[model samples]
Target: MGHAADSVTACLSKGLGASVGTIIAGSKSFIAKAKIPRKTLGSGMRQVGVLCAPALVALEENKAKILAEGLNKIKGLKVDTASVQTNIVYSDILKGSNITETHLCKILEAHGVLTMPKGPFKLRLVIHHQISESDVKYTVLHSESCNWVHW
Candidate 1:
């Protein structure tokens, strides 16, 4: 069996970058309850093997390397290193900061880095197997270089 992106958010879109959820392991009772909500949320898809195959590969191969990259790599983006336990990293903008989240997002996106904004000055950055250490450094450097006040 190959690796898989075990995620509740379909792996690809928000969870594991698989574009589909594959790994399901829970008590029968728990699964039964979850299935109802899963269906209600339209999480099911046809011929998911195509997506699952890659997800499996990823889980088996890249899990450790990706984890070791760490959440503290992104400079200027403050994240409590001890608190990060997964691929998600959250950063907040100061109340009096000149840059807004939207402005920062646009600046990052312009450089081919995409991020999700949580609030006017907050951002949620997700790290995955596709992101390399060099990529992280570049993103951090570029992010720090953004002068949103002028824009």
Candidate 2:
């Protein structure tokens, strides 16, 4: 099927959980030409198997739901667990909370957890293969601290 396309690409990060890498395929001539820019952009490297190993584990684990369920238990945060189908989870800050999503992210980061603010009141969390059950618990523990009545 690739013969019909000039080039094909797939990311090995995100859901695949590879630290970082992408697959690019094309005609031999096209690939040869592509190598120059790949190296120029510093994407060409040796021993990349180390970076690609986690994807295999990701295929066997679905940690996002675990994370989403945990987040749903936290106060001031609303998560539709049914919508969590992959490695991404989104939580919204309920109206009663004074804490914005950005503030909540900073609080989590200060406690050794990291998250991204989706909008003024939404938070985005990505559960990669590297995150263990204990890590999820830690995230939830800290997130629960944000359950302050001030929110």
Candidate 3:
């Protein structure tokens, strides 16, 4: 049997809505061998139920819909449609926009639009169950509204 529970947290972090968890997978013996080390990092894995329970419910929700809205509703950010086979979204900051990726990230955070930087002028946004259509809209609007960047 080749049963291994790999990085299944994406099912929750990406599909459902959980803050943290990068689970790994391995055979039984391997897992047993790592038990001591895993336990050594005890509380780091605490309160998992806080994230797991919602993930279970997320399985029943429409993951594709969110992905679609996220893909379609964006304006100022450019995404390659050909590569959007999954729930991950990458937005490239338009060149000559005058604002660097770091400054834009700070602006988005100020407006409650959280995202990760993929490059000097790129951002990675993930579509999850917790994100609603309005959230996507807000991101697009705020991102495109960087008027001061033109100067």
Residue pairs of candidate 2 with colliding backbone atoms = 97-151, 98-151
Candidate 3 — which residues are off by over 4 angstroms? Answer: 1-76
What is the lDDT, from 0 to 100, of the residue 104 in candidate 3? 77
Q: 39, model 3: CA deviation in Å?
A: 20
Per-residue lDDT of 43 in model 1: 79
Candidate 3 per-residue lDDT over residues 1-151, each given as its tens digit: 3345532224446555655545544666765666678789783444657766665665555343444445344444566655655556776766766767778788889998777888887877766776666776777677667653574
Candidate 1, 1-151: lDDT as tens digits: 2235322343343444555544464556766777788789977634657767767655554333333233234343455654445456677665555677888888889999888999766788877757666777777767766744444
Off by over 4 Å in 2: 1-10, 18-56
Order of candidates by lDDT, top first?
A: 2, 3, 1
Q: Higher lDDT: candidate 1 or 3? A: 3
lDDT computed for candidate 2: 0.79
Total clashing pairs for each candidate:
13, 2, 0
| Poorest lDDT segment (10 consecutive residues) of candidate 1 | 1-10
Superposed Cα deviation of residue 43, candidate 2 (Å): 14
The TM-score of candidate 2 is: 0.65
Which of the two, 1 or 2, has more TM-score?
2
Off by over 4 Å in 1: 1-20, 27-77, 147-151
Q: Candidate 3 has what TM-score?
A: 0.53
Give TM-scores for every candidate, taking all chains together and pairing residue i with residue i. Answer: 0.54, 0.65, 0.53
Against the reference, the lDDT scores of all candidates come to 0.61, 0.79, 0.62
